[model samples]
Target: MLDLTSMKINDNNDNNDNGWLELALSSNKDNVKNLIEIKDRLILAYKNYENIITEYTTNPIKSTFLQERELLKSFYEKAPKNLNRNLLEQRNEHLFEQCPFCGRPCKPSILDHFLPKDLWPEFCIFPNNLVSQCDKCSTKKWSHYYSDIDNSVKFIHPKFFNLLQYIGIQIEINFPSPESIKQPDFIITFTLPRGININDKKRLSLHIKYLDIKTHIREYITENYLYWLRVSEQKRYYVPDSLNQRIKESYTGGNNNRWDVALYLAMINNDFIINHFDSIEIKKEIQDHSDIKLEILTEE
Candidate 1:
């Protein structure tokens, strides 16, 4: 995940109420006697959108808060055009080359609502609340998360934390017998900075499962693991550190958030992989394989 700080909000056209942001912020409808009691609540919500939402928390109101404020459905309908033109198109950079949610090399064609607009319809068009993500992240995060049950933030909000920087993911491949090498179990585990609070940790773990991020990384890690296995073998298992260095340097040019970057780093530093890559038991998996070639693995 790219750090929220990596990209800047394009607020050049925003007015005092921050234009669309106000409509979402006012959706909570604090003390209004009736829907008729307050008018222009949308403007109020937009004006206070930034201050109302925090980096670590989201509203838990069950009855679509924005609907109580006004005809929120109308705003939801028009959000895409504005989000793309006003925010995405205005940006000088594409924000990220890969989806921050999955770390795949795909364009952020879909703008995802960090908080589902269904529950918090008010934020449907809120610039800060929307994220540029791929279909995988968008489809996977299909409102299964309900932070109100535990009062914990379910995932890292790009508006709040640079999760990609403070959090780390390591992939573990449970090798099978030479015959079952194709079906190895790939386990993804996470480690966070020591200073991170427990609440954040809970959400981070939830975020991984919520998006099925590890499962997504499963195939990539296995392929890369197999590819690296082949890389070491073709070189006749000559120099361990030299080959590890080559792999590490190749992925580092991308960024801290990339999956391959983390994968190569973990494999290179892992004592077991280093000592066992050249073993006859493991090399057999590569030597006997006919599915893909080592040269092509690097191409992917």
Candidate 2:
């Protein structure tokens, strides 16, 4: 995922330059001091967001904050729309290039409220809380949470958190026999960087699991494998260095931000995939990795 540097700042000649934040606060202001109150609370919520993330601590359930959050929620309930189409388009096309979450290739179809609207409608239109994602990803993220107690689960935030730097996927291929290269076995696993604690690790694992990342990757692999199989008989796929080259190209295109980018890089780097370019390699077995366990991902 890309960093949050691309999010726009205001052109309003204001020194503070909180463009999106200022617009959100003023529009929601409703000409009442309550709007000012909500803005103040929003500032605090932003503070808490920063503290919780930077300090790596649990969220404190404060009553005052909760009441303000309710007010914010009520405001959203009667708002004109969830997001401004002009803003979404401007940001998606000019600012945010792609859905950083699933690494979908283009501007997303839906504007996802990263924190579910039902749970935290106060964050409904919050810039940092709003992530541009495809319909599929937006649907999958509905009400998804690793922990019910707190919002401390530092899962992949397409807005600020970049999973590309911290997590790397590894593909392992296990053959049933040494005789043939067709229809063997494979497993995909993830590796976390050093110094990451157990709680963070578990949270990251939960993120990948619930998103059905393995399933998505497995599906792509199978489709690609089938395509290669059909072509190999005619020597199209059997041509030396083609698979690796394609993978490299995809990785280069994505700059390692997309999951498929990592996946392709993994495939190219994998010795077994290089050795046997025509195998369908269904992931029917678990591999031996201390940090990551293989799951049986199905086509269905």
Q: List the residue pairs that clash in candidate 2.
A: none
lDDT of candidate 2 over 1-300, digit per residue (tens):
455434522232222444344655556445435656577666666545544444434543433544555556654444433235434553456454445665444566666666566655555545556666666667677876445554455356644555534555665556677764556465877776688888777666766666766776666565665565455544523433665576666655335545544545555665665655534221211221344857998996
On TM-score, the leading prediction is 1
List candidate 1 stretches off by more than 4 Å. 6-39, 55-59, 62-84, 87-93, 102-105, 178-181, 223-257, 265-300
Clashes of each: 6, 0
TM-score result, candidate 2: 0.61
Expressed as tens digits, the lDDT of each residue in 1-300 for candidate 1 is: 666654434461244444554333344443323433433554455455555445346654454264453455444554334333555452324656777666665567877677676766655566666778878888987665466675656666665566655556666655555554445566676666578887667777777767788777776677866776666657644445665675666556444456676666766565566557546546656666855656645555
How does each model score on TM-score?
A: 0.64, 0.61
